[model samples]
Target: MLKVLFAGTPDVAVPSLRTLAADTGHFEVVAVLTRPDAPTGRGRKLMPSPVKQAALELGIPVIESDPSEESFVSCLKATGAEAAAVVAYGKILKEHVLDALPLGWYNLHFSLLPDWRGAAPVQRAIWAGDSVTGATVFRITKGMDCGPILAQSTVTIGAHETAGELLERLADDGSHLLAASLEAMAEGRIVPVEQPQGAFEVARKITVEDAHLRFDVPVFAVNRQARACTPNPGAWCELHADGDANGEPTTLHVLAARPIADDDRDNFATMLANRAGNGDADGTSASSLNPGELLVTKRKVWVGTVTDPLELEQVKPQGKKAMKAADWARGARLAPTAYVK
Candidate 1:
């Protein structure tokens, strides 16, 4: 059996640790390396990373020291680990730390090699409208996720899947891929192949500003933006009373949304015009809903985009709990011309 050291931090990394620990016949997880406890929650109490918690449950030794510390290399050498497996460890491994193990470290990245290489592959893939994305297990080199690939597995992105939902699936599926690659490495059955050379996209970490929704963009673009940021720096927009430029804008978090079909858009527009008694005799007009304009009915809420409107399914207003979009509109008692910016 190959003795392995595991390095990881988030909940996404837990599955691979569990898989390797359970496969006692082929692998023995000697120890786990993870980030130290950090402040979390509203109360700001320090809490251990998910990987550290899992390691404790599995009765494995854990090293939470920074890799840059001089003693970190010594601590790693003491674990008697032959190689290391990493998943979202959230730290750079310098040459000295890499040299501590006999076999080089392998990292499980949540994207195909040479694509979406960076800190936020999953979110970037969704934001870029990638129809398919996958995981790659590669030997860790000095460059960021630029190592040779040992194995890869692809999965289709759902039409309306949010980054959080897609990431959850990838984490579960990629755990098996990581384990298989390590098993092949142990048996000397696999060779790492260099990634293809070419221009590729980098998935930089998403920031709070990146999650702000732009209603001026096309409906599909708006939909993608909202999905890409869901459940994390969540998609948001500024809500102000119509023509209330001097009023303080409320931040509205869009939890779920979808593009309105052409027919549905027309129907909604006509309904709004009829409610306001502003349409022609046939309740039809050549005018389109201006971007950011809102049309809220008893059962639904739609916001205009460049091309069409996006239906808001769930939303949270500033300092308010999440609720159905229609419910929020009703409670706020917004004007007929209310819109978001």
Candidate 2:
């Protein structure tokens, strides 16, 4: 069996660690390296990372030290591990640490090699409207996720899948890929392939500003943005009551949304306008609702976009729990002309 050290931190990394530990015939997980305990929850209690908790359960020695420290390499070498496997370890490993192992360190990244190579590949892929994405196990290099590839597996992105949902699936699927790659390396059956030279998009970490919804864009774009930010820094917009532009704007969190079909856009707009007593005789003049305009009805709440309107299925008003969009609109008692920005 190939003695290996495992490095990971988040819950997503737990599956990969478990997979390698269970495959005792080919690999031995000598120890696990993870981030130190972090303050969590309302009480701010220091808690062990998911990886650390798992290592304790598996009876593996745990190391929670900074990789950038000068002594880290020696510490790793002391574990009697010939190689290392990393998954969301959440730190930049220096050259000396990367070279400490005889077989070298391999990283399982949640994107195809040379594409979306950065901190937030899964989130970026969904935000940028990627139709397909995959996981790649690569030999760790000095560059950020720019390592040579060892194994890869692809999956289709669902139209309405949230970033959190897609990441959960990728984590599970990639666990098997990661375990197999390590096995291949142990048997000398895998060769690292250098990444192709090309312009590639970076998946930088998502910020709170990135999660702000732009109603001025097309409905499809708005839909994508909402889905991409779901369950994270969460897509949000400023709710402005009619004739209250100078008042404090309420933050509205968009939990779920769907674009109005092209064929139904005109009818929906006309119906809303008529209900608000703002439509002309033929209703054609009121068919074009301004972007960011709100059309709240008895059952649903729709927000206008550049192309068409989007139906908000769930939303969270400032200082309130998540609820159905229609219910929130009713309780808020917003004016007919009130809209979100």
- Report clash pairs, candidate 1: none
Q: Model 1 compared with the native: what TM-score?
A: 0.96
C-alpha RMSD of each candidate structure in angstroms: 1.7, 2.1
Across 164-280, the per-residue lDDT of candidate 2 in tens digits comes to 899899999999999999889889999889999888999999899999999898887888889889888899999996537787788999998988756655667667668768764
Weakest ten-residue segment in model 2 by summed lDDT: 280-289
Q: What is the lDDT of candidate 1?
A: 0.90
- For model 2, what is the C-alpha lDDT against the true structure? 0.89
- Candidates' TM-scores? 0.96, 0.94
Instruction: Give the best candidate by TM-score.
Output: 1
